[model samples]
Target chain A: MTSSHLVYLIALPLFSSAFLILMGRKADKWGHIFATLISAAVFGVGVSEFMAMHSRAGDMRAVTQHLFSWISVGTFQVDASLLLDQLSICFVLLISGVGTLIHIYSIAYMSHDKDRRRFFAYLNFFIAAMLLLVLGDSYLNLYVGWEGVGLASYLLIGFWNQKPTYATAAKKAFVANRVGDVGLSLAIMIAFAQFGSVTFDGVKAGVHGASPAALTALGAMLLLAAAGKSAQFPLQSWLGDAMAGPTPVSALIHAATMVTAGVYLITRSNFIFDGSSTARLLVVIVGGITLLFGALIGTAKDDIKKALAASTMSQIGYMILASGLGPVGYAIAIMHLLTHGFFKAGMFLGAGSVMHGMDDEVNMRRYGAIGKVMPITFATFGLGYLAIIGVPPFAGFYSKDKIIEIAFNAGGTKGIILGGATLLGAAITAFYMTRLMVMTFAGSKRWDDKAHPHESPVLMWLPMVVLAIGSVATGFLFNSGNSLVNWLAPVLNPNNVESGSELMKPIVVSSLALLAVILGVALAVTKYRTVPVEAPEDVSIFTKVARRDLLQDAFNETVLMRPGQILTAGLVKTDYFAIDGLVRLIGAVVSGTSTFLRRIQNGYVRSYALIMVIGALALIATIWVVTL
Target chain B: MDISNYLYLSAILFTIGAIGVVVRRNAIVVFMCVELMLNAANLAFVTFSRINGNLDGQVASFFTMVVAACEVVVGLAIIVTMYRSRRSASVDDASLLKR
Candidate 1:
């Protein structure tokens, strides 16, 4: 296949989404199946393209397809083009591959929903947008895809918008994403100003000529955009609330596509980040903070999907943190991303399966020992759990341990601090994930008599089983010979060489990471081995704060929303009084003067004659005066 | 006679007619005063033509005499209708347009 087929990778899902939506309720019975088939078809296309690329050598692996001239001006030009390269191929497979599985799962999960067709349409739209995001060759072209995914995410999150809170959650996510989008816009503008072009190739070639200050600014702005999309730190309050969406949506956003966009953006812009150590350090710090932030929140969440969402945030944090570690960390971050996509998506689908059996009850406190009833969900979800905790031979072990190794090998005090943080994040991740497992599957049954936990249909568990297999195998396979790293070197680090000495050996790092996981697991098992049906009312201040999402919303309201509200109110008052008052004053003066002048029109003939005679006398007097 | 003296007599007659038209309330009186003013203007035109030894002013006086004749016909008719409608000849009775 030629590179021109790249367009179909995006267009197929996009047009199918549009078609299903336009067909409306008439296609309800088969709309979901049609959507699934389209997703699978897109995946097939991506696989064929991958096979074609694999047959080629180093320089030829990356291919570009130019569709048309997008924008042109004096010395400024852009093309609507697509790039199917090593880095994007990984994302393509993950998005469409995991996306297809989620689609299959949704067929059964959403079968009872009357608007299931609309849900599939949104899912297809999300897949198309995500594909565009990775395949776009330039920052400007990528923006279209960025916004596309944001819209899809908003629509899917609010799919059950009859509930007011669900609608509000969607709005929150959209607003937060807008904040990040501003960063992307600014970064693109900076790139254009500095390099005179916005294409990835152009920017990479020009980066050597650009000043460090400009590069740092560009890098910082890109990171800001990543932070928004990936739910890192201050911009991340929406991820937990976003769980108000359906379970498949959570899996798609957290595991497969939407949140991983941040990692893709940073890695794609590796040239800029490499030039700016300040920006790189900032990315690492944000990643470090958010990993802990999400892990802490995960430990306190009662809702099962929300807990998984928190873990997704923390896992992305590891990827972001790893990407920030410079050349050595980029491939490792993507490896973790791919693995996280598998395990996290599988776990979320498993959660959905559990929900399907338990009347959509989301509280883990209310869910205990349902694993006995739903064996496939339990087994698949357990495999994912093991993978997430970085247990040996699992996907997370290879990827996450590599990130931990890289962090420690960064050298000096920086390495020590970053290494410590990753280690701590690993421990907390283990604790929260173990707590989730024990509460949902290990403890005594906490549900009421009305609840009957049963296995989901074959359609639902099949996808989970496949992803669970991925979680158990993908990390080892990708790490066996550093194949993923070597494959991505042309894009991430063309002059690749091992430059640094290790502060901690890979074996040491693995041991420490495993120890941390064991410690966290032991604590969680001992503490939550017997969870009460009802959560205790009196908790420590830390638990209380964590339970409330660490006051992120409160901080935003006080620091951002309140000031914005005040400013808007002041502007409104000024417009009403100052601007409008001036117009009102002008009108009043004209009307008042007209009223005063109107009194002279008395209807008496004698008075009119007297005035006319006086006017004639005055005219004669004026003539005499002028002559004299 | 000198033409200046004729002009002064015409101006005095015109002023008197104007005062009569403004002060008198009777519609018939006002009509007669307007005719007087028009004739005074025609007298001034004849005097000016004699002084200048030109036919232009004489032709103008003839034109004024024609217009005055037409005015008298229309003005007298309007005054008759006003008297018939209001049962009074006062020009003040037709002041409805003041406001």
Candidate 2:
């Protein structure tokens, strides 16, 4: 198949979403079915495209289809185009493939909602935007998709708008993303200013000639954008709150597609990051800090969706960190992103299944011994848990272990620090994920008398079962013999190959990672297997800090939001007392003069006649004086 | 009589009518005063026609009298409606337009 065939992958969902929206409530009866079929068809197109690309000759594997000239003015131009390249092909498959499963799952998950058609429409819209994001050939096109996804996410997150908090969460997510979008838009402007082009290939070609400072600025700005979209470091507070959206939204947009756009962007621009060591190190530092940041927060969250959201943050952190590792880490980042797409989407679906069974209660403390009640959810969630913790033979083991091994082999004191950070993150990840599983599914019943935990419908579990199998098998399939690495070699630099150290060999890194997982699991099982009645109030300061997301919210308020509020308040005062006061003064003068003059307009016809005669006499006298 | 004397007499009648219109509260008295001012203007026009040795001013007076008759028809209908609605013909009581 030619590159033109890639349009099907994007167009199917785009048209379906448009149709659903246009049809509105009239299509509510079968809108979800239409959405699911469209998503599945897109996945089918992605698979075909991937297969055709895989079968092509070297360098022929990449294809670009130019649709039209999007913008052109005096030596600057961009195209509305699509690219089916090695890097983007992976994103296409992950978005559409997992999107299909989530679409199916949402049919049952959102069955009771009166606006299920609208929900499916938003889901399809998200898929289309994500596809555009990955497939676009230029930064301008990517930004169009970027804002499109942001809009879709805002709509989905606030789908149940009757609740005020849900609306707040959606607004917060939108506002926070807009902050990062500024960074992206500025970076694109800089790209065009410096390189005279915003296309991926054009920018990549121009990076060699550009000054180091310009490249660093571009890279740093891109990192900011990524951090916002992927929920890294300072911008991450919105992701947990985003769980106020429907469970399917949390699964598809938050856990799977929308959040990983950051990694894809960074990796897509690997050439730039590969050029600037300072920028690359910044990416690594942000990722390293965020991984630990998310893991710490994950350990303290009691809400199931929030905890999972935290875990998603930490996982994306790992991918970002890997992308920052330079060219060697790009393939690893993409691999991890793909596998993460499978397992995380599965785990979130499992969480949704658990919520379905447990009357939509999200507090994990009130959950226990639900494994027997929801065997499929437990089984799928268990597999995903194993995959995430980097257990042997599972998906995360292959992908995440490669990243850990690369960090160790980075070869310096900085390398060791980053490596240790990655190792610590892995252990924390294992601990929290295990704690989640044990508290939720392993212990004695903690449910109240009114609770009736049972299995979700076949539609929900079927997707979970497919994803669970992928969670088990995808890592080994992608990583063994470096199949994904070789496939991505033409687009990404292949120089940063795995250079195992004598001290930190692959076996040694794998064993160490495994040991950390084992330790984390043992700690969680010992503490939470027989669940406690209530959390102890007098916990250590560190635990307290972690539980409150290390006061990240407070930090944001004091540092960012509070200052903004103060400035706004000052402006408002100025408007009220100064700007509006001027207007008020003019209005008062006019009204006061009118009030004095208004008595002359009293409805007495005789008074009006007298005034008219006196006015006529004065006019005649003035005319007589002037003539004289 | 001298035309100047007639003009002076007409001016005095018009002034009294104008004063009466300003001070009077009753609608009927205001209407009668307005008619007196119109008759004074008609007398001045007839005297001016005699002095100018032409009939233009007399014809104007005739047209004015026709217009006055039509005005009286419309004005009395409105006055009658006002009296029926408000139980009074005092112009002060017709100040609903003030609102």
Candidate 3:
């Protein structure tokens, strides 16, 4: 709660990264030690913060560490203060907790990488940036961390720069995010213009006094910024492209920490969003579309990591849904975030294990009947699938199921849409997951004889095994109606955990969702399992309509891509002509001057004297006119 | 005329020197042109000091003159070096790039 405690979270990693970089070429050996220690300690501090928050859940603890006055002008002041509250704690937990797992996993994942030291250093750097992002009390400070996370993501995504595709993917993620970041910067300008303040506390107060139209516009614009960062709907295409990065990074920035920043921003300004139903509805609608889209696309992908990425997109949809539910749903959304962090990290690591053994072959078709060879990996994979599918008694089931109930309780068209959309996504989730599980783990052997797929090293499996436990236990935390909700009763205060199950009639909802999950498993198993255990790499219908993401990529290529290329060419052409035109004009003037001046070199002394006389006469005439 | 008129006249002279530096092909002329712009700015600084009844402007001008003198000496030294090395002061012909 003191300044030192707040300072430690940031300074520990910041200094260690500096120390690691200073070690130069010997960075790998020393860098690993520094990164692992800092992340674990930060996670410890986060746990303490959560405990502290839990103790005082009813009151928002304004833990401020005022480093100095950041800005001071004519009636404009903002402190370089770090804030600790429910919001900061939630982010701190995500950054440090998921961060710790990624750090450990990297020790194995990047052990053979030549730039292992640099990898650890970048990981630490991202954590520090993410910390600053969450802990900053003011908009300007948050933006510093916001843009910093963007820089870290860009660097880490293309860690293997030898591949041009990796570099392009990194650039795509960076540039696309910049488009949304502009809205954030503009929104900050608007906030400053209308309210003359930028602190979280200040802006919240200002919103109360602001016009409804202004509030709605500001809220929607801010959510747009969040949507890009969090991979919601229109801005989500870059996320699929982000598979070019290391899998551990997908677990960290893409899944756990960085993408959730959008929700953090919106939820922090819960007061502002509550004022505008339109803004809230837009949130629900966008979230619903992304959830359904991501899961469907996820179902159609063969690259193991890309499938997880699409699933990441879908999971973030649930977070957006929770955020739109306001504060009551806020706790559930964050809990969902926490549980998703564990399971998603584990699933990615498990996929990494399978890839490691298969010599980087991630296509599930090459991996059939892997359950016998790698039992541990298979078990963790099964737990992850269950957690993700929201099977009863798992963390994903509780958190995801709660979101569906929240949607139904909100009532009206949106309620029905969210509730229905989430259920439908749940079915596809089960189907694709069942299809994937059977193809990868349940069916007969498929790999070549020389390729011996085995369990990952214990270093990797430890994290997966632990997270599998978390995914199973976490859902039950919320099972007794208000159990999970009551845990955070301190934050939302006196309001009893809205028995959402009661309101939405959880019995019917659960049975229906349960039935959907069952149906998905049944159909996928019936079609693929008994057919000689030979899941076709390309079923004609699956090939035409499903696998290439229903021709989204193809459609983008012909419909969006060709036109985009032409437009880019046209812009370049216009730019080229305009620039070349100016260059030629300047060149012509210079050459013309050179030509005109050549007469001076014609060896004509008498003519030169005659020109001097004419110049003198002209000057005298001008002077005489002025004198007159 | 007010002291500002002298400074204003110096400015016009400086501009003429600047154009000579640009228009001429001799290194010495360009070196002399830079001195002219510095002196013009210094003269304006002093004029404004008197107009405002302050001494800070004059003090700055004095320092500017000292720096400008040091710069001129350095500039000539470099030109001398170039001449010794290349045996030419015609700035256009001193294009070692072509060689």
Candidate 4:
């Protein structure tokens, strides 16, 4: 039963996919229902697991369900075990819970689409992959999940392959992901060679004896992998372009599951991150840098989903920053993870509703004022907005507030700067989100004749409503000592747990931050409201710098994207000349050799046998003479 | 003839036949030359078995002759097919075998 549970996280979707595919032509038509039910059941399993673990809070150790031994030859062995520890359990719950909501949301969002069954299939596979990612107790299994999500992201991003941009966007994602995969594969090899183990438990238990130099090298390489996966710094620009996918795909896989895999990987291997001070510092600095960059870019983005994509990057930055801090790191990190999931899902779905109505147009300037038209979407969107900007009584407020407090109390100027930057980033998040809300839902309808705005179907709205309720209420439930982390505490080391700021500091700082959020919303209310102002065609200078997507666009365009194009072009030209010339030379040589060989083949058998005898005698004489 | 000397002579003869098969252009000649090499090797085996006072080697040589005869039959059938198709017995013209 235990072994089967581990494979269930991986095989169930795969098994169902076979069934769904065999049922083929009809399977896709009814696929969304089965897919959604499967994910929801997985969520039920996660919740039940949490409760089961909760009921047994007296246990101090983790749950190690050994599925089987994956590899064992000589001294090397890696298990196919599934671990239920404090960290994995927290993410298992988050992935399944949020995954179900996204699946349900997709039901109606994709209801009207052609090839809807294929969409459901990809979505189900993605959930299974993400589950495997959190559940796998070994590096090899985790890598499978990592690549699985990458494959899913590519498929979903290019779901509408007819659109050249979507296909290109998918290509860009796959290529950029390959760069990160190289770093991850390299680090895996290094860990295997140095520590002789790739399993989580083996690596954690054994790596303490490894040379600090090797540890630092391995840590830096892992950080590089994490950066590319999490969309920090150099790779941050791809997520913005990844918005070329469907709105729901942009919401779940791109914004939530796929992008966060990097952070999750780093957090899961905290023993490595915590051991190397240099590596932890690198995580904080890169995370802080990416956060500041993502927030600023979001402020200047015009497309609602694009802006939200930028916002997701910035929010993930806070979580990455949490991984760099002390014992409290995992709790604060997962808080941001959960809250961000709810609000970001809401925001993207809300964008979908607007796009649904406006014939899929995402320009903010062209949209204005329709709160009454989409009361459910707007209200849920509003609640989501408050949660995102860290308004009081909303989920983001508590989580973001805790992370910021942890950052400040981390006791350095760097900590203070990160805290302040995170706070200001929240304000900007509010500014952009309010700008979005006011532009889309606050005024009279400004849609063109081809566009007729209407409410999304029940399937879409139901998830929005559900996420809205979670966004509004989850923070309170967490704050009352009934937090998700408490549920996770049974499998953790008590000494390392954050016990999360039972002090006045978090309250004071958070209340002030909430006030700042309101002020931001107030500013947006004043500015974007109908003054008949023409929006700037070019960003104002400071905002333009921000809009260069934190110089990520600039970096990638210069270092990666543009260079790649040039190298490809150069290779094409080289192939035309060098390869063609070489091939022609080979052709000339072959003709020359064939004619020469043909000359030797005059057909006298007696002469050929005489030549053969003479040649053999001469060879024997030559060998005997040389030795003498 | 003493078996050891006869074996060496047969080996040399077989080497000559193989060379002829490789260097000759006429398909019929190359086919006959390959058969000569197989016969020469079989002769060596039969002579060595008589010298060693053993019947097993002679038996193996007998089986080898049967296998070689079958190969010749199959090889001739293929060559005849090619000859019929193209009306030529030039081995170089039959370029289908990449090797």
Q: Which candidate achieves the best lDDT against the true structure?
A: 1
Say which candidate scores most in TM-score: 1
lDDT pick, better of 1 and 4:
1
Tell me the lDDT of model 1 at A100. 96
Q: Residue A180 CA error for candidate 4 (Å)? A: 1.5
- At residue A10, candidate 2 shows an lDDT of 77
Chain A TM-score for each of the predictions: 0.97, 0.93, 0.90, 0.89
Docking class of 2: medium
Candidate 1 yields a Cα-based lDDT of: 0.93
Q: Is candidate 1 or candidate 4 better by DockQ?
A: 1
Writing each residue's lDDT as its tens digit, candidate 3 over A1-628 gives 4444887788788877777878888766768867988999999987887777667635555477887798899899988889887657767876897788778878888888888888888889899989998898888888888898988889989888799999998987897788778868877887888789998778877877888888778778888888888888767877887878887888788877898888787776676777787888778777888888888887777678888888888888888888777666777777787778878877887888788888888777777888898999899989988998888888888888878887777766767777888889888888877877887788887778889988888888887787788778767765567565655445443345453434457777888888889998888888666433233555668554656665656765798779999999999988888888889889999999999997565443234434654676699899999999
**True interface contacts reproduced, per candidate:** 0.52, 0.70, 0.00, 0.00
- lDDT of candidate 2 at residue A503, scale 0 to 100: 47
Consecutive 10-residue window with the lowest summed lDDT within model 4 chain A: A487-496
Per residue, candidate 1 scores C-alpha lDDT tens digits across A1-628 of 2477999999999999999999999999999999999999999999998899999998889988998999999899999999889999999999999999999999999999999999999999999999999999999889999999999999989989999999999999999999999999999999999999999999999999899999999999999999999999879988998998999999997556899899999999999999999999999999989988999999999999999998998999999999999988899899999999999999999999999999999999999988899999999999999999999999999999988888888889989988999999999999999999999998899999999999999999999999999999999889888899999999998879573798867888999999999999999999997888778879999999998989999999999999999999999999999999999999999999999977756776666777887898899999999999
Give per-model TM-scores.
0.92, 0.82, 0.80, 0.78
For A11-88, candidate 4 gives per-residue lDDT tens digits of 677666556656777776678788878877777777776676666645543566777788889998877778776677
Question: Can you tell me which runs of candidate 3 are displaced by over 4 Å?
Answer: A1-3, A53-57, A60-62, A478-484, A487-504, A530-546, A550-572, A575-583, A586-590, A593-597, A608-628, B1-99
Can you list each candidate's DockQ? 0.46, 0.54, 0.02, 0.03
Steric overlap count per candidate: 0, 0, 4, 2
Q: Quote model 2's TM-score.
A: 0.82
For model 2, what TM-score is found for chain B? 0.95
lDDT of 2 by residue, A1-628 (tens): 2467877777889999999999989999999999999999999988988888888886888888888898888888888999889988888988888999999999999999999999999899999999999999999999999999999999989999889999999999999899889989999999999999999989999998999999999999999999999999878888988999998889889988899999988999988998899999999998999999999999988888999999999999999999999888898999999999999999999999999988889988899999988998999999999999999899999999988989987778878998899999999999999999988888888888899999999999999999999999999999778899988988886564555454477898899999999999898888776766577779899989988888988999999989999999999999999999999999999999999999899998999989977997799899999999
Model 2, native contacts kept: 0.70
RMSD of each: 3.2, 6.6, 13.7, 10.7
